[model samples]
Target: MTSADLHTALLRPAVLQILRAAGFGHARPVVIDTATDLAARYFLLLASSTAQNAFNTHNTFVPTIQDVRLALTQAGALVPQMSTAEEGLRDAVEIEGVMVPFEDLRGVQGFVTWAQGPVNKEIRRIAGFGDDANVEEIAAGLDEQEDYLTALKKKHSKTGEESRYQGTILGKDTELQTVSIIGGPAASIAEWTQQSLSTAQTATLPDADEPATPATSGISSAPLTPIESE
Candidate 1:
């Protein structure tokens, strides 16, 4: 399969995991594909909007938090939209010649609320993590598993096998050595390459004492006799 198809296929597993965490016991293949496509499109839209906003407002392609927020706002992804009455009230209440909506004042309040709410807690619980466990603990658990697997492999391996392949691609340890050309004018590859390049350049150059010959147009310089009418 093509790389794009493979990348899209890889996203399906993450989508399935999210669905499972969100209490979906089973989903059809069509459903999974649709979810993955929607997720990919949403991400692309956010990135495109963020880049445009950054370039238009800040004269830069690099997006900042403000640009991302603006993108989210433009996409209507930010929650807790201000009602007309609320907007009127907010406009009426001005602080130091500046007026800001109550919802706008609570920046990313929806995201923070969702992260701290029951839904996030349930997701964490479903993913085999405690509510209080942070990212560091999760990362450490993965590392511990990897370490255990490595130790198990070494324990099961025959003695001296690892040492025999220690300097090769099959081994874990890396080997370093200097390379030298035995019978070349220069001892090392780098020196030989430099010397060969210098010789080639010298051959192509003209001698300083030699006078330069004018280029020929490949046509006879003598005037041609006019042909008589036949």
Candidate 2:
């Protein structure tokens, strides 16, 4: 979704209460939108991984609650780790009368409620009440074309002296010639593929005890023999 959609979803009254708790109540419009984007991105990863994890464990396409739990636990490990999201979803909810992970995807131990609480509650809370917060007053629409990207831009354009690459990265005396917020050089990297593929395809692997023999037009040099009838 666009930043505006995420901002609106996140600013819902229920989510607002949570965000308020997390220091978003009086936060600036940009800051709040940014946090919402981060959260939305994180949960997207969580949902995908969780669903995939469930199906993977069962060796079936249909995801079970146990899969949900296992996936949540595993995906949650990447909150600030291997995950792309800044904060990952929580893993392994404590059952009322069971020792943490109950393994079986049956009964009330289902992760439906566990997965369906807090954030979900707050999200649905806005819909249930029909009193979603008016984020228009919070700030201008985050969905404006190219607005957010421009906001994040910090140009230091000047044809002048420069510093070492490491020094520039560390914000030393000289300014950066350029820096990409999104990613690194793609065209250059794509060009780096090895040309040795031809050699590998054409080169003949000789028997350890025999001298090398090159093939002509990929045909074997073994002599043709007459077919023998059984």
Best candidate according to TM-score: 1
Superposed by TM-score, candidate 2 places the C-alpha of residue 184 at a distance from the truth, in angstroms, of 64
Q: Estimate the TM-score for candidate 2.
A: 0.31
Error of 2 at 50 (Å): 1.9
- The digit string of per-residue lDDT tens for model 2 on 5-38 reads 6556634433445575444447676765666666
Pairs with steric clashes in candidate 2: 54-67, 79-88
Candidate 1, residues 164-198: lDDT per residue as tens digits?
A: 55764335676556579899799998888999999
For residue 98, give model 2's deviation from the true position in Å.
Answer: 14
Residue 220 miss distance in model 1 (angstroms): 4.1
Determine which window of 10 residues in candidate 2 has minimal summed lDDT.
Answer: 78-87
Off by over 4 Å in 1: 81-103, 126-129, 135-200, 220-230
Quick one: RMSD of model 2? Answer: 19.0
- Model 1 whole-model lDDT (C-alpha atoms): 0.72
RMSD (CA, Å), candidate 1 to true, equals 7.8
